[model samples]
Structures are given as structure tokens and as C-alpha cells.
Target chain A: MSKLNDWVEASPERERIYAQEKLIVDTAEEIWEAMDKLEVSKAQLAASLGKSKAFVSQILTGSRNMTLRTLADIASSLGKKVCVRLLDAHESNAWQSVDAVLISRRVAGFAEVEVSNDPRWSNVIPLHKESCKAA
Target chain B: MAYSLRIAHAVENISRNLLVNLYINSSQPMDEYHSGSSLTIWLWEGAEASWAEAEVGVMEAHQAQFRARLARLAEFGRLRVPDHMNSEGDGIHAVKGNTGLRAYGWFDRVSGRRAFIISHVVLKKKQKLDPADLAKASARKDSYRLSKESK
Candidate 1:
């Protein structure tokens, strides 16, 4: 195990703190991404929410505790929606790997269908295209 | 040369060598995810010592947040949030938090693999980062580079 893993696993308190901080950082990062995508500056966001620029800065910098209402408000201001997901410990770490596998499978299926429809593969798998069409 | 000046130079050399040694010995990949694309995050010994000196709960929380940010940088190849992480020019970047904790480092190709090597950590008391702190971090970075090139 890495030193970080060992440190986190050494105590339940440490793990709890780590999990909590991770969520906060993740949520803050999502909001930042949304703001960037929408070209919304912190000052603009603060103005739209009728709050001070410092308040918006505090929320983005993880200085203030953000409530669900605050998150909803920010999302509404940015014309975005809030999404919350709860994953088990195992799934939390491996979600990307699982998603990558699922994505690769979907892409392979599409490639197979495309290949089957190609004239080069018509003689090799004459019935494959018909089966794909029916599916 | 004056005795005091000679002694000062010797002490400086010793400290620089010690820092370089610490940089070499403390290099480790942060295990935040199982992805193969993760970049190695090297925590300098000084940074670890400073982090260790923090209050237990605060230390754990900051370390967690820092690790998460590094993981995101590793996975995504860049962190879009300038508030969380930003380049400090000349290839040096800072991973900062609202709690006034900042870890300064630079990216370099280590052993032919890209890595973000943390040179030092500082807890800022002022609203603006003291130029001295950045200079110290930059010095450490230069020392690390010189040592690497010599090897």
C-alpha cells in the first residue's frame, strides 16, 4: 500500500475525514467546471445570487460549508442541475475502470456492426448484417 | 574570506544537500485510484514534515484534499480550477487551499515519466504569498534539478 493508503487505513477517524474532504473537493470542482463551461465569473455568479463576491469565493475555495440549498441556488444561477451519487467504497474507487470497460464494449459492438455492413465483410459473414439489423 | 562567511556557505551547502537527499528518498506514487494513467505525486520530505506538524484533524483533512486534487490532476492531466491549483510561472505550480495551506512544486520528467515533485509546503498567514516563500521553493526546485543532472 502507498503511504497515503496506510495513513488513511490506520484509523476510522482518518478515513472519515478523508472521505468528507474528498466529497467537498469533488463538489467544488464540479461547480468550478460548470462555471467555466458557462463562462460565469465569480463576481457574476455572486451578482446573480445577490450575494457578495467574497461569499462566492468562499464557497468555491471550500472555506464555507455549502448547504444543499446553496448548491441548488448556484446550479440554478448557472443554468445547470445538481447531481448527487452515493457509491460504496469499492465502487467509488473502481467506477472509472468499470465505466471504461462498459464504454469499450459499446464501442466494440458498434465497430462489429460497421464491419459487418462493409462490402469487404459481406462475403465473410453474409448473414451478420441481417442479424444486426434485426437486433 | 571571513570566518562567518565561510561558515555560512558551508551550512548552506549542507542544508541543500540534505534537501536533495530528502527529495530522492521520499519519492512515492500517491495511490488515489487504480488507473494506470495516474501521474506520480512526489512529496518532498519537508512538505511531509510540515504536514505532520499540523493538528491531527486538520492535517488529515488537508492531506485528503491535496491527495484528491493530485488524483484529479493525474486522471485528467490538468485541473481546471485555478483556485485549487495554479501555475506560479516558470513551470512551478501551487496546490492551495482556503485554509491557507499551499504546496509548491514543479513538473519534470523523472526517469522518463512525468511527475509533479513537491518542493515544500507553507501555511500562509498573509493574504498574499510572501515572495520569500516562493523563492525558497524555487531554490529547492533548482537544487533538485541540479542534483538530478549531476547524477
Candidate 2:
């Protein structure tokens, strides 16, 4: 294995970061899926949200930090609302391996976990539990 | 269970088996059981959702075909791959779909399961998987094995 792979395979911290980032990326992908289902183009969505197309593109592609306000705006534009759910460890299969860290993160509150192509230093933003609490 | 976890579990099993230092993870290297044909597949971590995105219909068709293959294996004691879609010699069974989409996986019977266990799912865009993808899949299989050994 390469140095990077060896590091990732060995590092619990890196794996936790990877899992958290997967959640964010999956969430962004879900937003893209909603747009696909609604047949809304990025430009159309941007126009409706009073934002630039690039902004919408960036957020949905997981390129930019997805703010709560932004998530709600996008959802409302699509006749939806931003919904967050706390999936139990068993309920979250992809997350099961990294459950220990995620459980800590969730209890610490909802937060942004970034995944860059480089596994070295993805930023971990503090999560505000109030913003992401399940309704 | 999510398909991702299912893949993870299968890889874990394959890795543990290989760690006894007796098995190989490849298309041509592994042995098949007497009851059913075995196959190998590869899946990149975190890419499961995208499997249904582009080429939706083709993806659905391929998924349906995969289901049918599993059904046949369960009912008829055989799962045959069409020549155009299946390839050998890499130690990984490569299944090619129309529109340049491809998947890598394998089937083998495991303990506690009557049907063959389908493991390692690597989604590819080119007809041929990049060498890195193959290496990654192999490394992952080994990682899974290591995890089990430590446990």
C-alpha cells in the first residue's frame, strides 16, 4: 500500500473525518437528486433562489460550505424543507464502522466536516446542534 | 441494510478468508464451490448513491439483470455471464454495461449463507478499469481482512 493508503487504513482520526465528510457529501448529493427529480436546472434553481448559478453549483457539488440558511432556501424553492434526522448507529450502515467518532461528533452537536481530495488536512467546522436538530 | 454495508461485510469476509493466507482476491485466482459459480466485484467507498444517477435506465437495467442473475443462482445452481459483458484474467470479474459503465464483483459461497456471497463493488466509467482502481480494490480487500484479523 502507498503511504497515504497506509496512513488512512491506520488512522482512526482520518477514518472519522472521512465518515463525517461522507455524510456531508451524501447530503449535497441528495440535494442534487432533489433537483433532478424536480427537473430544475442549476441556473433555474439559482435564479429562483436569487443567487448565482455558480453558487448553487458549488453548494450542490459539495465544493462550498453548505450553510443552514442555504439548505433551507434550496429546499423551500423546491417546495420542501430542510429536514435532519438522527439515525441510530444500526440505522446508519455506511457509518457503522466509524460510529464511535460520529456518535461523539453528533453529541458534540451538528457540524461541518470537509473532505478534500487530499486526505491530509480536511477542515472540521464546529457543528451547531440547534441548527441541525431533527424536527 | 444499505448496499454499501453489504459490500463492506462481504469484503470483510473475503479478507478474513484470504488472511488464512490460503485464498487469492482476483478474477481467475479464486476457486468456485461445487454448488454454484463464484464471481468477484469491487465497489469504491462512498460511491453507492451515484450508481443510480447517470444512465439511470441503463443502470436500472443492469441492476435488474444482476438481480435476475442472483435469482438464477439461487434457483438453478448457476450464474452465467455473457462473454461480451464478462471478462477474466484480472482475478476480478468485470461486468460491462452499455454506455461505458462497468462494475467489478465476484460471487462465492460463504459460511452461514446458502447463496454465493457477492463482494467488492467498484464502479467504473471506462470499459476497462484503471489500474489504480484495481489496486485500490485489492488494498481494500486486504484492509477488511486486517480488520477481521485484529478482531
DockQ for every model comes to 0.15, 0.01
Q: Which portions of model 1 show Cα errors greater than 4 Å? A: A92-135, B1-37, B54-63
* Best prediction by DockQ: 1
Best by TM-score, which number? Answer: 1
TM-score of each: 0.65, 0.36
Query: Candidate 2 has what TM-score?
Result: 0.36
What do the candidate models score in CA lDDT, each in turn?
0.63, 0.44
lDDT of 1 by residue, A16-117 (tens): 887877677767777777787789999999999999999988887677889999999998998766655565664333222222222222221132222234
lDDT of 1 by residue, B64-150 (tens): 777667665554345667778988876788877666677788877654445677777777778787788778778878777777777
C-alpha RMSD by candidate, in order: 15.8, 16.9
Q: What is candidate 2's CA lDDT for residue B108? A: 35
RMSD of 2: 16.9
- A58, model 2: CA deviation in Å? 1.0
